[model samples]
Target chain A: MIKDITLGQYFPGKSFVHKLDPRMKIILLTFFIVFIFAARNFVSLGIMAAAVFAVICISGVSPKMYFKSIKAIIFIVLFTACLNLFYGTGDPLWQWRFLKITQSGINTAIFIAVRIIALVLISAVLTYTTSPTDLTDGIERLLKPLSVFHIQVHEIAMMMTIALRFIPTLLEETDKIMSAQKARGADFESGNFITRLKALIPILVPLFVSAFRRAFDLAMAMESRCYHGGEGRTRMRVLKYSKKDYLALGASCLIFAGVIICSIYLPATVRTGM
Target chain B: MKFIEVKNVVFAYDAAEEGEEPKTVLKDISFEIEKGSFVALLGHNGSGKSTLAKMFNGILEPESGDIVVNGLNTKEESTILDVRKSVGLVLQNPDNQLVASIVEEDVAFGPENLGIPPEQIRQRVDSALKSVDMYEFRAHAPHKLSGGQKQRVAIAGIIAMEPECIVLDEPTAMLDPQGRKEVMDTVIKLNREKKITIILITHYMDEAVQADRVIVLDDGRIIRDGAPKKVFSEVEFLKCHSLDVPQATELAYRLSSSGMKIEGTPLNETECISAVIKALS
Candidate 1:
């Protein structure tokens, strides 16, 4: 059951989106995020939604996965949208003691809900298409400029790689340790809040001890392979942007510009509670 | 010529508590491993075999002796990289040694660290995977692989660096019998075909019997060192040190003690069968 936790879930594919350079994908994702926020009226929001939908279709990941991602944050989305419903001040339709739903309240609630859903779906496109390693590599390259200030960018990237590599291993170990503790009659399920927290100590102690041991062995193994640091080190998988990446970047920028222009020209149908 | 020379190596770990005596792991240990030879180091737990394996790759510096790998003294800070490049050390646990999520990426880790160009690293990674017969699983996640497959990938990671010698410290200790066999076959093939020197530290006498030479350690000191046949022939001495010889040697030793005469010690089953049959005839 614990194995089902899909952190940074990526579906491997030969789709155009998947094949784009990860750095370009990250940049395109940033533009899409800005475009979503820049959207002021229904016209601009609809256009941004259309652009996101097109990219989602191109990503080749099933719509089910995107829905699943949205389902995870459905509570927060609904809660915030509900709070925005009563704050709108235009054309009150229904009145309560301290809460009044206006004509624009419904409009504002729909806008906020749609925006949050669009944000989740669009971000899902980025993660669904890019592998974790590629994403980290892209981030490392993007942050490479920080190294000039003695930021140890390479060290951070290495830590990320190792952490990603060990996630599954540590998860499996946790499962095993939990089972061992259960077999030894350690009750974890029936305890109260504080007792449940205390029950975790037995599992956490062994897990930490094993993690430290694994870390020591890994350091020695890396050293034996002559890993001194990132200095003068070359990467096996080089990130090179292709024509498709440039094309994708151009398209995202154009879409953002269009969204901004539409937001400026269109009459505000929905009150944006900024 | 010797690929690795350990001269009177002495190593000890500082006491964990105050007023406690230091724990000496290895003492006056000396041995020479020839180029392109398969050597097995045999010892029980706490015999310092793993410590000696680390010393080969300059992972742990000797306290009072010298270890020279490929004519580079490991004690020299500047030559440590060169020393490691020549003698790659594979640890006991396969899970801990793999640094990358994917098999091929992990193999490329060594060459990448050495600053090999991307194209060459790719070629090295592919060929190294092929050598270990793990090329088909290049895209497979390491955690998804079996213990034997992971160990082979670990070996490929070392091979990608093109190390002249590899010191494996009980690599199959955590594996099943099948996995142990797989690693042994890989190590033997690498030594015979690739001309890479192999020093395997294992407690399995059967595994040691396959090696060209066997060195037995007892309580931080080398008790015996010679060809496998010669060392296994000294069954009484090995047993006294709490070490085991091959099953065949043990059986022959038992027969000899039971008032039956066995001419030579057999290191494997077939030889033991032949010796027993000859005696019966």
Candidate 2:
């Protein structure tokens, strides 16, 4: 089903990763991404892979669920790996017309493939663990410093969260509209690209009109609830850093520091010798 | 003192085109809604009832006159938020009104904006959900709920703010039969048990029968204002204005108009049935 797209979807549970504060998970995800990019050798990449696996295991989410995120970026991963295959610097293994694949190209391809997988899985763990509401609150809290610049951080976060909440509703509405048009014998699927684009005009017009009407209604409701601004607003689910959060933070920092040290001191020592 | 005071409040929408006249939606409307009263505002489409409900919460300021809610004039800039705090308004579309995905989180949206303490906000959300019997669905997504349940959660959202009065403008208009009853029961319970004043704007004559006072509007004017039995008894007056009376009241009126001597006008089913039984006896 179209609703079953697993990207950025969360599963509610009380696993160790889910129990961590959203802010902590967000921060850890940032460090995890950096660590993945910093690893240039097999050992450091293996460490990155191990850390992601550990998070997935503790999160109690199926590895298959985490793999679903990769499906979304498979094109980019394949493109990059294919591009790197002909650009390696050492010992050309196959030569074609004006193109060659080297032993070092194969090694670099493997490294990048691991990095991409680790990066996607590490971020998937974040989304899979934290609900969208908590994620928004965490983002608002993290960006509170931007308020000094007079940026409307809370408003932006509120907009994002509302948009997220409406995604499924709007998608469902679109599905219904498509079906209704189909029932009326409106051809949507068999046409050429331009004709297919033309077919969507019926759906887009009503969707836009309804969306504007909903925006007006929502604004009135918000005003009725005494929403002036973020100045005096209080939150029900207050974000806090507990002992587990601190422990998770400490572990992420250790791994980040280890990767940085390894990258600086052992760049060529642990290279994959494929 | 009356909970809400409207003094000849006048409002109009902007003109649609150049040289076109701006349409007046509410004109010279003056009424006082007392504290803890269940008043239903009944009007047909374009009768200005929804426009009047908006004025009560300062969503639309009157062009000429004034509206004071809980002793704060909605005209003053500083008092608008405070006035809104006292007079919470629920709207027609249940889907648009809910901001949070989860039930409890959506309930918390109101008090959170009011700047309540975290612990107190939690308490209010819990109590509000319980009052609406939606406590079990606290963690459930609002989108997944039935239309009636969503409207109930919307009411719970207003209740969390603990407003003295709630103005619901066609809240159950989009709800199914069962959902409408669920919302009406919650509204009545809030009024009777919690003593929260209710200003319900509806076109459903049956729902208006539950109100203590029914105010009828036509052409942006108050055509009738009285108890439900008294107002619904004026069958011709309402019919002329393109409005309806409750089914029982209409039947009773039909029976009376046909030369039968029905002693009393019936506003609901029980009263209608009993009146028929008495006439037979």
Candidate 3:
């Protein structure tokens, strides 16, 4: 029952978007996010939204899945829109004795909601198309330049890779330990706040113990294979920039430039009293 | 040549709290397993079989003795990696040793750590999966596999490393009957076909009966070391050490005690049945 939570999940596909270099996806996603902030007028925001929807369609991942990702942040989106609606003041459109909704307030709410939606959709597209390992590999390659600052990019990547590798393992362990504890009559579903928390102790204790044990074993196993630290380590699947990736990058750059131009040239709206 | 040589090894686990005396786990254990031999270590709980297995790969340093693996001392830090690589350890719990979410990735983990070339790692992963009949589940999430399948994947991980020897510590302890059969079959096949040395640590007497050699551990010492027939022949001695003889061996022992004429000891069900028929005739 706990497996259906698909936030930040990857959906494997053979679409052109899914086949693009993850490094390019990372760059393009960054470009997309920057353009999202650069969107000042409805025309630019609409263009950006259309581009995201197009990418989503090409990736073959359902819009329903994208909305599922957005659902998690729905509360935050609403809260931000409400805050913007109440705080901004200019040309009151509706007035109650002490409350007022102004023209500027309505504009601000719309802008904030649009920005939130754009941000969520663009980020969701990247995650939906890219696998966790590919994303980590892209990050490692992109951050390889940080080695000049001795940031240990390989170690960070390896850590992320291992963490991603162990998520399912640890989840399975948790499930097993939960069942074991349940068989021992350790109730995790009933009782008050403290009682439930206390029940979790048995599960958590074993899970933590097994996690540490696994870490030690894995470290030993890795060291046994002469993993001295990613120095001069070559990956099995080397990242390569192909023509498709170049096209994707070029298209994203054009959209980003258009957004910047629109943000600079778009006229500011002036509100009159209602 | 002896692939693994342990001489006068002693080991203990230090209590976590300060000012506590270290508890001895293995005491003056001595043995040598030759290359390409399948050996089984059998013992009741707390008999120190696991500690001895750990010493084979230098996971635990002997307190006061020597363990030489493939012409390298296990105590030396420099040779530890070599020892471990030479002798891969598959722990008892199938869940703990698996390092990746996908079966293929888990199989690739060992080769990746060894810094094998990507192409070679891929090939090895494929062949290793095929060796354990898990090739079809290459892309499947390992968490979704049954206990037997997961354990097979774990074996494939070690096999991908291309180790000369594999040590399994109670690989079937948590498995059901079918899972146990699957794992045991894989271990035997790896031993026979790949010529990888197998050191299986198990409590099941039936599992030990198939080994080329069986060594019984009791209170941190080797009580019996011989071929399965020789070891099972001493039924009273095994029972005294808190270990059981194979049921067939027990039945044979019972028949012999009752003054029936059975030619030799039986360590397997088929042999015991034949012995019973002979006695009846």
Candidate 4:
């Protein structure tokens, strides 16, 4: 049952978007998430939609993946959209006891639904192109400034890297332990909630024990490799930005300017989005 | 000159009882490894070979006396890091020792720890991967490789550090026959072409036969120390220590005892074959 949880969700490709620097991709995503919510009216929302469309097109990923991401977050999107249906103050389109639907409420519900879907799709595109390891590396690079505030950025990054490295190994180990228990007639399926929870104890205890053992072993291995708290340590694959990153940064900055201009100059009454 | 010097070193495990004496694992052990020499330390279980290997790199310090690694004493705090930098130790399990997910990243791990420049680290990782013939898999995950390949990668990790000496403690014990041969070949290539001091600790007599010198440990003491031919020739002594000689060496030992006229004890198949031919002729 645990086998289906895809940890990385990485879709390997060589599209222009995929080839962009990870730090650049992350910075782009951050701007995207903020500007998306900062959008107040139709003009900025259209611009955000155009940006998402451009990323999707340049990414060369099949549209099926974006839909799958939307499917995964469908419940939250529907719940938020339904909640927005009762929110805006405007003419009632449909009336019920303590529940009246306004025309603006219908518009706001659509806007909220589309916003949630776009958020999921944009983040999905990031994960699909960038590997988990590279994603963590990008995060570490972005968080490098946080070290000035006495945060242990490098340590967190190392921990993240090690955790990512061990996931597959531990999953394989869990599969083995589960099979061994199953062979001895330990029923995992066809049980009540409590019974299923009880059956998990057999699996969880051994998994925890082995995980601890692996941790101890990895700690020793790190010491043998002369790992001393990441002080002055260098990496084989250094993260460096290229021309593509610069181009993406410029394009994103221009889009942000457009978004801000549209939000201010464009009147709220021109409410095509909501 | 000696690449490593151990003089009157003693090590003991902590005593469990308040009044009881500590259980000694290594007692008054003294040895020196010549620079660029291939030496095999042979011992059965509980003979302290692994403990001795750890002490060489300052992983475990001796309880008494002093050991010097490339002019740095293992006893000093500041020098211990230098000693480790100079003398790399590859333990038994490759899986446990590999720190990086990628092959080349793991290879560069040791040099990176030493604070080598990024460019130099790149060059070293490339060369080290090539040395182990694992260059093609540099981008592949370390867990995806076989036991032999992983051990080779581990060796490459040690080699990238440019350590003057490498001490492998039963590196082949967990490998299959083919993996064992793979690692042995890599170790031999490193010793011959690179002229790196190699100290291989194992009970495998075939591996010891390939070494320039074999030092046998029994009950935490050196029972025999000499060339492989000289040491394995004492078949009865080795047998008493619960150790076996290489098959050809034992064949010669058995045949001669059965009234076959073998010239001398042969250390390997080639020597044994020629000796038998000479005797028949």
Question: Going through the candidates in order, what is chain B's TM-score?
Answer: 0.98, 0.98, 0.97, 0.97
Q: Taking the tens digit of each residue's C-alpha lDDT, what string does model 3 give over B1-281?
A: 68999999988899879999888889899999988999999999999998888788887899999999999999999767677778988877776677656788878877776778899988998999999999999998776789999999998988988999998989999999999999999999999999999999999999998899999999899988999989888889988888998888888888888988887998888888988898888
What ordering of candidates by TM-score runs from best to worst? 1, 2, 4, 3
Q: For every candidate, what share of the true interface contacts is present?
A: 0.89, 0.86, 0.43, 0.45
Model 3 TM-score, all chains together: 0.91
Query: Which residue runs of candidate 1 sit more than 4 Å off their true CA positions?
Result: A268-274
The CA lDDT at B227 in model 1 is 92
Candidate 3 segments whose C-alpha is farther than 4 A from its true place: A3-7, A86-90, A95-100, A169-199, A220-227, A268-274, B16-20
Per-prediction TM-score: 0.97, 0.95, 0.91, 0.92
Clashes of 2: 0
| Better candidate by TM-score, 2 or 3 | 2
Question: Which pairs clash in model 4?
Answer: none
Give each prediction's root-mean-square deviation over alpha carbons.
1.5, 2.3, 3.2, 2.8
Q: Model 2: runs farther than 4 Å from truth?
A: A1-7, A93-98, A269-274
Q: What TM-score does the predicted chain A of each candidate obtain versus native chain A?
A: 0.94, 0.90, 0.93, 0.95
| Two-chain DockQ for each candidate model | 0.90, 0.84, 0.49, 0.52
**Candidate with more favorable, higher TM-score: 2 or 4:** 2
Q: Which candidate is the best by DockQ?
A: 1
Angstrom error at residue A198, model 1: 2.0
